[model samples]
Target: MTGAPLLRVRDLNVRIPTPGGELHAVRGVNFDLNPGEVLGLVGESGSGKSVTLRALLRLHRPPIVMSGEVEYGGQNLLKMSEARLRSVRGSQISMIFQEPMSALNPVLTVGEQIGENLREHTALRGRAAQDRAAELLDLTGIPSPRARLADYPHQFSGGMRQRAMIAIALASEPRLLLADEPTTALDVTIQDQILRLLLRLRDELGMGLILVTHDLGVVAQTCDRVAVMYGGRLVETAGVHELFRAPKHAYTLGLLQSLPGAGAQRQPLQPIPGGPPNLRALPPGCPFAPRCAHVTDECRAAEPPLREVAPGRLSACIHFDELPALRTELQEVHA
Candidate 1:
C-alpha cells in the first residue's frame, strides 16, 4: 500500500439522467487497489458499490456520465476510445457479475463462451481454446470440467453457474478482477466455497480484486481491506482487521452493530436510523448526516472530505473521535 497502486481511482463520480432528475450514483470516490489484494466495497443496497465498479469498465449505458481518473498502469480508462477500451476490458480487467445466468449466454455452450474469450484475448484457438476452457473450469473446481463445458447456463446449478462465471472471467488472465456480489445468491455453504476459491485464485494469479458486497461477514472472510459506502460516498476505509477493531465512521459502526448475534438470547439489533438519502436531492452537507447519531451542526453545514484519520485509514467524519467510542456504546446497547 505504500508504493504505487495497481489501480488508482480519484474523484470518481457517476451521474445518470433519470425521469425524475440527474441521479448521482457515485460521488467523489477515491481509493487504491494494490496488486493481489482483495478490497471489499461494503454497503447496503443502492449505496453505489456496484455502480462504482461498473463505471470502471464503462459498462453502464447512457444517459450516464462519469468523471474521474481510473488509472491502470498509467493509462486513464475513462479517456480511452471504444476500440482501445474494449481491448483493455477483458484482458487487463474482468468482472464476475452478481448473476451468472444474466451474464452468461444461454444459447452458447459454456465451453464456447470461454473459448470465445480465449480466442479474443489470447492465441488459443480451436481445440486449444476448447482444452483451455475446460482447464479453466477445472481451476474453478467444477466437476467433470470437460463434460460440463458442453452444458449451457441453464444446465448448471446456482453454485455451478457462479463457478462457470468465474472461469470465464479468468480466461484472459486479467491483472485485476471486479467481482460484484459474487456470493450473494449462493447458499452459505456454497458462498464459503466461492470465497475460498476467490482467495486461492487471487494468490495464484497475483491479481488485484475489488469485491462489491453488502455482507460484512463476507468482507471479513474474503478481503484484505474494506471500504464502507453510504449515500454514494465512501464513509470509511481501512485494513480489514483495523476497520473491524476500530472503525472511524459512524456509518461503519452502525453497520457492525446491526450484524445478528449467534446467542440464543440476544438484545434487539441497533439498526441505523432512517434510510439512504435520495441521490437526486442529496442534503447540502454530508449525505449520511440524517442517519448518523454522531452528526454535528458542522456536519450538516458542509461535506467532510475523506481525510486520513489514522495510518492507512480514511474517514469522512468531522467528529472522528467518536468513532472509537461506538464499540463500547454498541456493546452496552446490545448487552
Candidate 2:
C-alpha cells in the first residue's frame, strides 16, 4: 500500500516584524517527507532551517507572519484553526528542540513533562499516564526509568536531558517529528547516540522525520534526502548519496569541500566568503552572488528558482551547468 506523504511544505515564507523592519527568515522553501523517511534541512546559522521547522509546528509568535502550504496527511496546516492546530501539534506532529534545558520546564519533573502530552492528547488518567511516561523513558534508553521519573531536568546530565526531551516528543506517537539541531550541544559520542536513537524510533514508529542541522555529516549519516538552504532560500535538494558525491550547486560544492576531511592535505579551509545577506533588504539578484566565486553579470540581474538539474536533484544557480567539476584531490594532496 502506498501511503501519502506525512508532511509537505510548498513555497513557504516566514517573516518576523522587528522595529527595523520585517526580517524574512524563510523564503520559497519546498520539500516533502514520507513515512519512515528522514529529510535533512541543513544550512549555516540564519539560513532559515529552524524557521522552516518552526513554521511546520506553527510555533511562531505574533508579529511573526507565515505563508504557504504545510500539508500533513491531506490536511493543510496553514489553514487549520488554532484549536485544531493544537490537536495536531503534540499528537500528529512533535518537535525536539536544540536545547533541552530551555525546552523543558524547570519546575516539572521529567515524567510529568512526558506525561503532560499523554493526559492532554489521550484518555489516559493518573497511573496509566504515569506508566506510559515511564515506558517512554525506558524506550529512550534512560536507565532506572521509574526512579528517574521523579528527577527534574537539572538532576540529569546534558545527554540524559536530551533523551528526556526525545521521550516527551515521542510520547504521543506523532506521525511527523521535527528535530531542530537536537544534538547540537552534546558531545560527539552523545550526539551519535541521539542520532541512533532517533533513527531507531523512526524505523519502529514509521514516522516521518525532519532533521534541521548545520552538520552535513549528520545529514549524510541519517537522512535519505537533504535540502541545502542559504540566505532564506533553498539552494539545492538531492538524495543523500547523490548530493555528497556530485553536488551540482556551487554553494553545495563549497559546503562539501569545506567538510573536515574533504581533502587529505588539509588545504586552508575555503569558507564561502561574506556573511548571510540581511533579510530586511535582500539584493535584487541572487542572494548568494556576492559570496559565490563563479558569479556572472547575469547572475546579478535576477533571482534563480530551484530547477531540476538531474533526476531527484535540484539547484537554484543559473550557471549550474557550467560550474567546474569537483575532483577528489585527497590522493593528489596527500602525495
Candidate 3:
C-alpha cells in the first residue's frame, strides 16, 4: 500500500438514462488496488458494487455517462481510445462475469473461445494456442483439458463452466482481475473450491483482484481489505480483521450482525430494517438514513463525506465514534 497503487480510482460517478429518468448508479466512489492485493467490494444488491466494477473497464455503453478517473499504471482508462483499451482488456486486465451461461458463447467450443483471446493478445497460434488453452484449463482444475476443449459450454457442469470462465480470463495472464460475484449459483462445496482456486491463483500469479459480493463471510475469508458500499457510495473500508473486529459504520455493523457466526444459537437472523434506497430518486441526505439505527436529524440533513475515522480506516458516518458502543449491543442481541 505504501508504493504507487496498481490501480487508482477517484470520484467515479456513473449515470444512465432510463425510461423512468436518469439513474445515478455509482457516485463518488474511490479506492486503490495495490499489486497482488485483493479488495472486496461488499454490499447488498443495487448498492452499485457491480456498476463500479464495470465502469472501471468502461464496459457500460453510451447514453450512460461515466465520469471521474480510473488510473491504471499512470494512465487513465476512461480517457483511452477503444482500440487502446481493447489491447489492455483481456491481456492486462480481465474479469470473471457473474454468470457463465450467458457470458460464454454457446455456439463456440470452449477451446475456440480461449484461443480467441490468445489470437488477439499473443503470438501463439494454431497448435501452440491450442496447447496453451489446454494448459490454462488444466490450471483451473478442469479435468481432461484437452478433451474439454472440444466440448461446448452446455456440455460442462456448472462448476466446470465457471472454471472455464476463469481459464479464459487467465488466458492472457492479466495483472488485475475483476470478479463479480464469482461464487454465485454454486453449492457451498463448490463455492469453497472457487474461492480457494481464486486465492491460489492470486498468490501464484501475483494479481490484484476485486471481488464483488454481498456475503460478509466470503469477504472475511478471501479479501485482504473490504470496501462496504451502500446506495452507490462507499460507507466503510478497512482491513478485513479490523473491520470485523471494530466496525465503525451502522450499515457495516448491520451486515456483520446478519451473519450467523460460528457456534451461534439457532435463532432468526437480524435482518436490516428497510430495503436499499431507490437509485432513481435517492434521498437528499444520507441514502441509508431511513434504515440506520443510529440515524439523527443531522444524518438526514446531508450525506457525510467519507473520512478517516481511525488510522487506515474510512467511514461515511457523522457519528462514527458512537458506532463502537453499538457493537456491544449487537453482540448481546446476537448472543
Best by TM-score: 3
In candidate 3, how many Å is residue 280 off? 1.6
User: Per-residue CA lDDT of candidate 3, range 1-335, in tens?
Assistant: 57889999999999999999999999999999999899999999999999999999999999999999999978899999999999999889999999999999999999999999999999999999999999999998999999999999999999999999999999989999999999898988888889999999999999999999987777877889999999999999999878887788899988877776444444466889989999999987888899989999999999999999899999998877877632323233222
Instruction: State the C-alpha lDDT per candidate.
Output: 0.89, 0.87, 0.91
The number of residue pairs in model 3 that clash at the backbone is: 0
lDDT of 1 by residue, 1-335 (tens): 46889999999999999999999999999999999999999998999999999999988877799999999889999988899998989998999999899999999999999988898899988888888999999998899999998899999999999999999999999999999999987999899899999999999999999999998888878888999998898989999877877788888888888877644565588999889899999997888899988888999999898999888889998887776643333233222
Tens digits of per-residue lDDT, candidate 2, 263-322, equal: 345666678778888999998888988888888998899998899989878999998887
Which runs in model 1 stand beyond 4 Å of their true positions?
Answer: 263-265, 325-335
Model 3 accuracy (lDDT, Cα): 0.91
**Clash list (residue pairs), candidate 2:** none
TM-score of each: 0.95, 0.94, 0.96
Model 2 worst lDDT run, 10 consecutive residues: 326-335
Clashing pairs in 1: none
Error of 2 at 267 (Å): 3.7
